[model samples]
Target: MKRIHAAPGTISPVGPYSQAVISGHLVFTAGQIPSLGSFDEQPESFKGQVRQTFANLAAILETAGSSLSHIVKVNAYLTDPAQLEPFNEVYREILGHAPPARTTVCVQLWGVSLEIDCVAELIAKENGQ
Candidate 1:
């Protein structure tokens, strides 16, 4: 059977979707906005939105018993193409050690400038210790 995970202390989904769904030890997550338990339209700036999105991803992954380090792939969408450089800077910080296979694209999002979604594999601790 599959399992679903919802992070602690996060605003309930504003739409019809779970924070994450796990199947056979792999968790598929939905796109995460820069929202921090707020009902407002997110994404204030390139850097701000990117950071918050990663933080949100981290929280959901932690809740699902996984982490960014375990991520196997990431799909990032940018509203403003100009922020690619700054975005890469931040990405290097988070994805420095073991970067995952990723694709970054600039797409239109209801006229917004940022959005990100990633897939992280569960790295079970050796011996379950």
Candidate 2:
């Protein structure tokens, strides 16, 4: 069976989807944007937007009993190819020590510059610790 997770203090999904779902020991998160819990407060700059997006991702992950450090894979979408490096700068600041495997692609997004989704193991099961 699968369990759904919704982080408190985060923006609710605008569509028909849960924030994250846990099946077995894995948690799958929906693509997160840079709204920072409110569409009205979305950041304007690229790096700022990236920070907010990660913050959103982190919240959902924590709610699912996982964390950034426990992620096993990630999929990132970028509106502009030039922003990858800037995004990585923030990524390194947060998850750089032992970042999860990730695949990033350039694509067009509406109202946001980037989006991110990830798959992670529950914290208690991380590295069998």
Candidate 3:
């Protein structure tokens, strides 16, 4: 079992860290921030922030030979729990019926309102490519 880092220049990393890692048949992604191309601005829109965070997580998962459909678990941290409904709406859109086990909690943060971290089980058909 070896750790695989899911970083391919799309996801944002403020410090020295890999975006995600694959161990055996599983992929574990680091916390994702809402960042666009410039990587300096996190928009004021809470919904936009949540979407961007998921996008970052998706990008990392793609690099690890996985996708949102393969996600088995997700842990989200939000600066405000009031935005949870919007977040849930987006989650339903992305994951459809096959939702992963998830936990969302409020946490103190700066310049951002949401963060998403995920674990995915890479399908064997998509592995060893």
lDDT per residue as tens, model 2, 1-129: 465545877888888899898888899999999986586678878889888888888888888888989999999999988998998999999889999999999999887888999999988854674
Candidate order by decreasing lDDT: 2, 3, 1
Off by over 4 Å in 3: 1-6, 9-12, 126-129
Candidate 1 per-residue lDDT, tens place, 1-129, comes to 344445875566767778888777787788777776774746676777778889888888888879988898899998777889999988888987988998999888754467778888776978862
Give the higher-lDDT candidate: 2 or 3: 2
The residue-by-residue lDDT of candidate 3 on 1-129, one tens digit each, is 544454555644667777777887899888888887656777677778777778778778877878889999999998877878988988888886899999999998766778789999876684454
Best by lDDT: 2
> What stretches of model 1 exceed 4 Å from their correct place?
1-5, 41-43, 126-129
lDDT per model vs. reference: 0.79, 0.87, 0.79
Clashes of each: 0, 0, 2
Location of the lowest summed lDDT over 10 successive residues in candidate 1: 1-10
**Model 1 CA lDDT for position 75:** 91
- Locate the minimum summed-lDDT window of 10 residues in model 3: 2-11
Q: Which parts of model 2 are misplaced by more than 4 Å?
A: 125-129
Best by TM-score: 2
> Which candidate model has the greater lDDT, 1 or 2?
2
TM-score of 3: 0.85
